[model samples]
Target chain A: MSTPIETDVVIIGAGPVGLFAVFELGLYDLKCHLIDILDRPGGQCAELYPEKPIYDIPAWPEISGQALVDRLMEQIAPFSPEFHFNRMVAGFRKLDNGRFEVETDEGELFHAHAVVIAAGGGSFQPKRPPVPGIDAYEGTSVFYSVRRVEEFRDRDLLIVGGGDSALDWTLNLQPVAKSVTLVHRRPEFRAAPDSVNKMFAMRDEGKVRFEVGQVTGLKGENGQLSAAMVKGPDGEIDIACDRMLPFFGLTMKLGPIADWGLNLHENLVSVDTEKFETSIPGVFAIGDINWYPGKLKLILSGFHEAALMTQAVKRIAHPDQKLVFQYTTSSTSLQKKLGVK
Target chain B: MTKISIVAFDSTRFDVDAENGSTVMENAIRNSVPGIEAECGGACACATCHVYVDDAWSEKVGSPEPMEEDMLDFAFDVRPTSRLSCQIKVRDELDGLVVHVPERQA
Candidate 1:
């Protein structure tokens, strides 16, 4: 019901590819707004392996994932692209006038002349533990992330995982929950030592219980959980709890994009290499989320796709404008657009 | 070449002649061994390439390094001998290495 923010292009993912698209699109004076599921821009480069070195990026001998993302951010700064973080594009439809409308999960709408989907792999979603039948309790007695701390008040909570999410939530929710039990596969924790120590201190005081194990089963009725069966070192044991929070980590899923009626090859959107445009007019797919014959899922390939896609996007956004190819090294106009003139 | 055997959850066996310096995960993927997702492509980031080292070879394969150990925390049903196959490089000492793929990856 709210007014949609209008833009020349709405990029679906704020990964390196998407960030580079802003630079390409900006060269032609096209405004852009990027929406990403992550809190920051880097996508997998930030989430999965920020410190890991990436060797394939062109010209750079070696750069860490986070470093590459940082450099891209700097490269796109002149464009002043608007970023919508911690949001997912839930709805997408083409209007009769030939423009596109995208709605986020938070209900914000964006109207754009062209849409670029540079979602690498897909949207990063919280990984669900491999416990059998756990899906039945999702959104009710089981939750992967804590949106509000008040929800667990006076409820028995079982927190699973050895990472920061599990330990942080354990320490934060222990006060509100009637009881809190921290479970992991090993005694060693991957969380910060400070949080792990605080959790252990709480355990020593009998405020919480720390068990080394994995949750193998869940007992509940009609989406309400009562107990969790854990296989610990000693043996199998049942931990009684009404709520469970498992922080396994995150995995990429081809979520709402699959339902947008676009042509899909396997889980990837089919795009033409000429313009990187999908089957849908004025909509494009690039990076790992796109598929073509001999398409390689590399950052450099995505950058090339972005440059090519921008040409087509400019045509859709400004049908009357004459297209001119200019290199940043030679053109004063391009340098001015990049703010280097 | 080191001969490595990767056993899938359903008991499917793939024996690959893994070249030295190549990872066990690479060989499994080359042979199309099912269940070795290796989602992060041997970055030691995602733990989808989880496999249980055959008991006899556990000593020879050695324990996971600290980074791999941290990544294993994301794997499913991790056991004492659980290792990310991507971190296990093929070498002369690891000849005839046998690892069982887990029921599911993280």
Candidate 2:
């Protein structure tokens, strides 16, 4: 039996891009261990708004970002990359043996031949507006991204944000939710046009109410989001609701990667284009955290980048081995080996 | 539309119509080709849709831009031919192009 131990790579995030890296790494027969700060897969897409539908992705006609994440998680289910979750990566440094010493916020250190920074543009948590009395009710009625929609099936939900996620969820809950009130900082919406249109339609039909203003106060009664005080153009308004969803959109973070000593183009890790090698030698960057003139920041791009970086890794790991996976003899394993098939 | 043919390490080939404005990765996903994932939704965040430009087409495809270079650090099985298909735009000079998709995308 193969000894269950360390790995060739330790991916920092379980986001789509990071999971995609696992796909490429497995093809190379390279052992890897995946880690993330979140308790589950799908990274930001999972944490921010799993229920929000994503239209920009080319393949899926109309699927929620969370759903796409679900598919990706299924794809990676087979390899079973050593998953370590709810632990954030805090630091990393290369060793004399050419492996990486990856450290996490939980005070855990890892040893790996290489490290992939799939941290999904860094750690992200909801940026709650400056509202008083919001801290006291930490575990009660407040929430970030709705992990379970069933809980809100019969409760009044107050969604804040004109962005796509906020608007889309409002429309999604129109039928099942007992009541939904969408509050935005501005009259215009930043979400997709279709979602915005649906929100407007719901408002016109009296199924939902729209408040254009900023949330100034959040008051809770018995540890629940009981009511909200908003400053609208008209004047102060007190709204009653059971819960509030502050989907202010995701703000990309660079995290401890900024201290990695890699060259940067606007704080992103700079790499040697030919080898995908970063300034740190053994360390590499991939996915949206990476940038290019016309970088697509898509999962496909991350996959492609992983392929190239893998080649570079091969050269580094087995420099003397023939560049090709073939050795003139027909072998069943060769087909799976990443050599010319 | 440009016609680009992409071959995978597994010998799967794709000949799809590429829209003029989209990147190669974007085109592959739109064509319903199996190779590229375009996760992060073509934002260059994930390398799920990586591909290799055939030797003849490498120079024409241009070097990895800074952002693309930055993200390559995360991709597995990095190859010299590797280029994030999403970062490559479909243009006239690249009418007949070829890319290689890796076998696995984690």
* lDDT per residue (tens digit) for residues A165-237 in model 1: 7888899899999999999988999988999999999999999999999899999899999999999999999
TM-score of each: 0.64, 0.69
What TM value does model 2 have? 0.69
The regions of model 2 sitting more than 4 angstroms off are: A1-5, A55-59, A325-341, B1-106
TM-score of model 1 (first chain only): 0.67
lDDT tens readout by residue for model 2, B1-106:
8888977667878788887877887777766777577656677765677887889999998888766654553344446677888888899889999988876552
> Residue B12 of candidate 2: its Cα lDDT?
75
Task: Give the clashing pairs for model 1.
Answer: none
Top-scoring candidate (DockQ): 1
lDDT of 1 by residue, B17-93 (tens): 88999999999999989999987778897899999999999999999999999888888888999999999989999
**Tens digit of lDDT per residue, candidate 2, span A1-341?**
22324578888788888887776676566677888888988887787767766666667777776898888777665556778898887777777877778877777778887887777567766655445667765546777677788878888888877666687779877787888999875566656788888888889999999997767777777677778887787887988888888764454567777777778776566776665667777778887777656766676677678878878776666667666653324655644453345
Global lDDT scores for all candidate models: 0.91, 0.74
Worst 10 residues of 2 chain A by lDDT: A326-335
| For model 1 chain A, the run of ten residues with the poorest summed lDDT | A46-55
